[model samples]
Target: MNRYQVATAELASSQKSGAGVPAYLRWVNRGLGRRAAAVAYVAGLSPNAVTLISGMLSVGGMVVLVFLPMSALSAVAAMVLFLAGYALDSADGQLARLTNRGSIAGEWLDHVVDSLRLPLVHLAIALCLWRAGLPDWSVVVALLFLVLSSSWFFAQTLAGKLSAKAADDGSAAEGTPDWVSFAKIPYDVGTLYVVVAALAYPPLFLVLYTGLFVVTAAVAAASLRRKYRALLAEQRDYAPEN
Candidate 1:
């Protein structure tokens, strides 16, 4: 097999479970990322280098969103940049796994970039909405979205780490429904970036953004509670008898 084909096979073998993954990431982003990862492998780029490139692309998109005057062209530019960056974000991990070069530091850097970028992206959207002379309520929605997205990111990450530690067997649970992925479109970061393209039309953007925020907020709340309770139960199970 050619080098690219070899890299593709390696990536396919190293992939994480698709359980609970959003449809866009599982289907679109991962496919794009696999190709990108194969290219990066052939180019001899390190995983960390791919990550830094992703960060730069994401920041460029945010800069355009916040700094450029709102217009159809700028909105499309931001969306393309953000989506490309997001695809590369997936590629970094795949590249790491393919090369067996995944490190604690690499994972930490990836999460740090994601944690910071998510909130800042929402903030940039808020700034744009305020500058665009949209209703005050619309700006408030953006700010609230920033808060919710950050909280959800933290909670979800912590819960995953804790649950893995608490599990008696390291193996992951199975049987996730296929529809769950589609149902999580509102919670997908890629979906959020796709929505950014609508920013050129404030009324349309507001309607879509607000709807996403509501669904994500509701889902986050329930998921947080479930995680907390599960952790508590695990703790009790592991507790020594009195």
Candidate 2:
């Protein structure tokens, strides 16, 4: 459709806000992403285009992590690419909401890309560390980190779906304060910023990544366990009486 038609379509679902976003990413998603979404809308670009671009950036960043020197400059370049990719990731969804043009297929593709990237990125980092002559232990730690990270992401997705299914009004949970957002930064997907920064110094990167992996594994495990129990209790409480 033309720009005017796109603008009109956008107005149909034009709230353009995100829920439960961390403060660190709030600026990227709400600020930069929104600006990009506006331009995309005017340019008549579909959300799918934005999604594909995001995927490309992410894939390129992973490639760099795997193949390039683990130098500061390389880390910076890869980090910039990742940041742009993530911003576009947010923008695609925003654009979809704005234009009321979201589709199940689009959402599925977005999540699929995300699921692919999360573990692969870590594995790439591990490979980079090994190439940098880091200890074998670090490589093992990185592999373990990949498994935990992917499991955590999948668990959170499942929890979100279950929560949505259980909510009677179909409304999202209430938003938390900015401090809570800050507290969550370590666990956020955008924590890759921290990852890339750490990579610039391989020794520090190993420690930071290992620490994050341990902490994240604990947090994800607890959250998933609690959510699972709650879901079980709900099912039992609502089970049909004989």
Against the true structure, what is each candidate's TM-score?
A: 0.90, 0.84
Compose the digit string of candidate 2's lDDT tens values, residues 200-225: 88878877787777778786777767
lDDT of each: 0.88, 0.75
Worst 10 residues of 1 by lDDT: 164-173
lDDT of 1 at 113: 90
Off by over 4 Å in 1: 165-173, 237-242
lDDT, model 1: 0.88
* Per-candidate total of colliding backbone pairs: 0, 0
Pairs with backbone N, CA or C atoms under 3 Å apart (clashes), candidate 2: none
Model 2, which residues run further than 4 Å from truth? 1-20, 162-175, 237-242
The ten-residue window of minimal lDDT in model 2 covers 164-173
